[model samples]
Target: MIHHKTKVAVIGLGQWGRNHARIYAGMPNVHLAAVVDVNSADLRGFAHRYKAEAFTDYRKLLGQVDAVSVVVPTNLHFEVASAFLETESHVLVEKPMTATTAEAATLVELARRKNRVLLVGHVERFKPAVRRLAELARKPIFIQARRVRPYDRTRTMDVGVVMDLMIHDIDIVLSLVRGRIVEVGGLAVRVHNSQEDLAGCVAWLLASRVSADKAAEIEVTTPDRVIRLDYLKQRLAIHPFHGEVEDMAIHGDEPLLAELRHFINCVNGEEQPLVSGEDGLQALEVAHRLLQRMSTVAPPVRV
Candidate 1:
């Protein structure tokens, strides 16, 4: 029961990190305490806009903030998140929690030992349609998920498509499926010079570069019906074998905003994190497996 406003800060003022700062600044129960970025020029402007302190190095805000959002690159997740967890500050780290499973496990253990909330920023889990799909997907026999976007060099270069894009569906599929992943395989092609631009597998598919507009959808097959979800449109469709399609009426909200609110709720001890550190670790483990298989065909560059 927090009687006073929670002091919060967002590190890494990239595009998504900027969004975190925006949402935190608007929250009534939270104080946008600080913002951090390597680029001092952009950091100063954002800090002034949000009326929060700016830091070139994130370590300066270690003890000052009650909670922190680690929106840095995937490679920096372990370093940035572990520092705050050790300081007893709750953390909301973006997806692909760390570069390796070992690092992910270390953070999870640190959070447990410190008795602090460690929420992973698997923002798709907060989408209303995805939330509804989790409820309806009781006996999913087959699942297919696709997420693709145009090539962007500004973000996600530290990792390949499997970690950057496919991990979202991997996390979602793990939640939906009751059985363990007994067998896994993958194939990838490098469309971008930096990382594998396209990758495909049995259950989930991901691509970072698309010829046309962006796309995101998940289709699940049950014994009786097929359910399709459009992530960007926030729409759900249920198709029975013999009947007309049923469109589910989903209440829409910004997924990132909902995710941040959940993080704050976990910080206040009012709720548990929907995507825990352990969950993020599991997703990272599976992603590594897929990457291992893909490497046989085309070795990925280590960023």
Candidate 2:
């Protein structure tokens, strides 16, 4: 059987986007067709190293690729991914999907209409620890997640930390709890940039309740025990009320590679996207709720 290689591109050569390019370049049965970024220097470097076409304008590769990873800024996600979808190309857009919930919904509908795969880049879903948590978190009564880090000046500052970081936790909690969010409230403060730099949100689910903290961890409590997952450490520990602490074994892999491979599989018609565009829209909805509340309540902080 002759297998045709899947032509793929990575739009946005920022820190995370470059990793996508590197991984796609090395994957089997995949051709890294192009890399796009406004920064000519970085684009040229990646193109030369990966031996793919380079484009400062993403529209140049519209009809040329089979699939693409939309790693651009939050504001540009809708435009870039929509264009690719219009060209019948599958898209794997990064987390938060788009700057607005409406934009997310549009992408979801567009992908459906075009019969193309629209996968969200919620990379955490690919983690082994997170996978185990999904299996063991049956009937979770309470959940808490913390994803905080020092401000990186180099990263895109177009959106607040809620949409940038907290959205991942929002996606996870929504996926595990699988309940309608009854209410949403949160407080955020802008310290370093125009956008909110720190945020904390609470979401009341029908069967489960969830909140956010100021660090990088997730704790899920059920009727019998509590499962603690450390995001950075990639560890899962379970503590029962009556028994000893039981550490859950996790087989870890580079999450980005796993996510990219899944996208490729979806493009190849071998599997469905684990994180679909609808899933991204759901997360973005919750994020907007929190942001809306915080905007009305939280006061600006002096840096």
- Clashes (N, CA, C under 3 Å) per candidate: 0, 0
lDDT string for model 2 (183-256, tens) is 88876665665677667766532111112333567899999999999877778899998899988667767999
Candidate 1 vs. true structure, TM-score = 0.94
Top candidate on lDDT is 1
Shift of residue 284 alpha carbon in model 2, Å: 0.3
lDDT of each: 0.88, 0.85
Model 1 agreement with the true structure over 1-303: per-residue lDDT tens digits:
647899999999888999999999998999999999997566787799989998999999887889999999888999999999999999999988999999999999999999999999999999999999988888999999888887765654777788888999999998888568887788787765657768888666655564367998999999899999999888899999889999976886788989999999999999998999999999999888888877434545689
Model 1 gets an lDDT of 0.88
Q: Which residue pairs collide in model 1, if any?
A: none
Candidate 2 residue runs with Cα over 4 Å from true position: 204-215, 295-303
Best by TM-score: 1
What does the lDDT read for residue 11 in candidate 2? Answer: 93
